[model samples]
Target: MRAIFPIVTVVIVAIIGVIVFHLLSFPMPWMLGSLFGVLLTQLIWKIPMKWPVMMRNIGLLIVGTAIGQLFTFNILIAMKDTLLFMFMLNIVLSLFCLAMAYLLKKWARIPFATAIIASIPGGLSQLVVFAEEQKDIDVTVVTFFHVIRVLFVVGLIPIIVSLTGEVPGAPAQGSSNLLHNLSLILLGLLLLPIGKKLRLPVPHFLTPVLIGLLLSLFKVDVDPMDGHLLHIAQLCIGAYIGLLLHPKSLRLPVRVLIGGISSAILLLVLTFFIAEGMVFFFDLDFATSYLSTAPGGMDQMGLIATALQADATHVTIFQLFRMLFIYVIILPILKWKILK
Candidate 1:
């Protein structure tokens, strides 16, 4: 009977994965992977096993560092105008999300830690990586809300693009760039160990970007095209997201779901307007502006930009800026406020 549960759960999620892989692209595929794991845990393993902590970290490292491959000094030069506006907008949105988290924390009577963790704009696995220290982490609740957060943004991507007269995103030349890919693998392996040992603020998920930038500034060559190697890394990420689920975690109550939905609505509405305002500030098109600033998962947002055939490159650029900004800049500001 116990074995039956795990078996059925795996089968169902695998089928869901196939559908998601075919219909969805990039970051949406991450969500589909997450959803499958959530369902499997709910139906089968009611017993809690600790969230697969290492798998989660490795996945974050893989995807986050993979992101570094997308960068080049030329891109940085092009972003000068866009960067200033985005910096201000990300600050505003981060504050906005912080306020919403406080409100939800009060309504739910959950711990400040859980609220803050759930409130973080992107990187679910990274946030929850620290959640185990809680007296009662309520991993399910945190997981549920962040999951919905991505789904909300992803679900709205096609609709938003259509309204703005945008087409699906095209693949970028740099996405497969040899320099980016090589730098990523080396960056991933190098910084991950140091990140774990030093207990750094945001960990080494973005280590590639930081390191790559340093190397670029120093004019060092570290070119290697190996996204094919990234496939296993992606699956590792999927598995980490999957391991967070337990059989009972999916049985969320009505009030919690309602509150989460309300919070999500609050987040999306705020992100949209902020993104639009950023467009005016940067002289960008409507689609690029909105998506670039849409406060969500880095990869998922990029994928949405990719699918729409819009300025995904620009959108992705902003997302990267916002992520690095949040992880590096805002985190210190927040340290006293929460992270500490």
Candidate 2:
């Protein structure tokens, strides 16, 4: 019962955030509100709050399944043309991150390995674990850097998209039958363990997406999820991220803090320029292009795509390709050339 208390407290706080953001007409209120609510509460009050990893995994499952339903043969065919483009985009993004890492190393006087790992735009939890495993890497600094970056990217992107006055695409129709939707969600839940067993990075999220994509290719008709369920998922993820960075965990100098924030802002500026190039070359909307190029995790970008009614499949493909590139290719090179 004691363990359950903190969980309940956290949920209540997140819900309050949702309500406040909703009232304020904020973009992605359920997510941003919950994240800020929990984050600010913890920072100011230093409350003893705990959110379990299970909550985050459940959220990912819902989001992944919904995104998977967006897949179709037509979408896949459209994506085929972008394969080469995404490859080149990832290369550019990697080089840009390396440049940022170099600046961080020089400004903050940290090890190159730590700066590089922190600067790489990957999942926060995974990078934290990777940093923890390395010798002579400051996990605290890396965590601080990523925490600041993710916060800035997630907080800023939605507002920017909304400010452009672009309306979301029409939401797809789902079966009106509540039972059918529940059944479909259960089927997705069953895939969670299979995803875990695959030993892939972000298996909890990507596994459902891959399975959903396969099903969609074969003409399976999974539809968009109910808004309420999606809201809950967003709330879960937001709360998890909100609770991620405790002010107490950061003992670094003010210079490191400034450097981290400056790097995040610089990365966003660079991404905007690259996104403009994509808009010209690909003939895609600015929202889709910007979200695709933003230095954020696949899950966060996917969520933003869905919210903004952008081509989520396109964003997912680009983000996933970048993620895999970083993990499989870039990390290996860094390990051998730099970390060694």
| Stretch of 10 with least lDDT, candidate 2 | 172-181
Per-prediction TM-score to the true structure, in the order listed? 0.64, 0.94
Error of 1 at 54 (Å): 5.6
Candidate 1 structure quality by residue, lDDT tens digits, 1-340: 7646644454455446646665755234443454454445555655433334454455555555544545567777888876667777777877777787788777877666667667767666555654554455677778877766665665565466567664545454433565666556656667676756765444645565456566667776554334554443444444444554343444677666776677777877887787677557666666666677675666655444543445645776777777778667765665556655
Residue 190, candidate 1: C-alpha displacement in angstroms: 4.1
Looking at model 2, the pairs that clash are none
lDDT of each: 0.60, 0.83
Candidate 2, 161-190: lDDT as tens digits: 788776466665755455655666677678
Measured with C-alpha atoms, the lDDT of residue 75 in candidate 2 is 78
RMSD of 2: 1.7
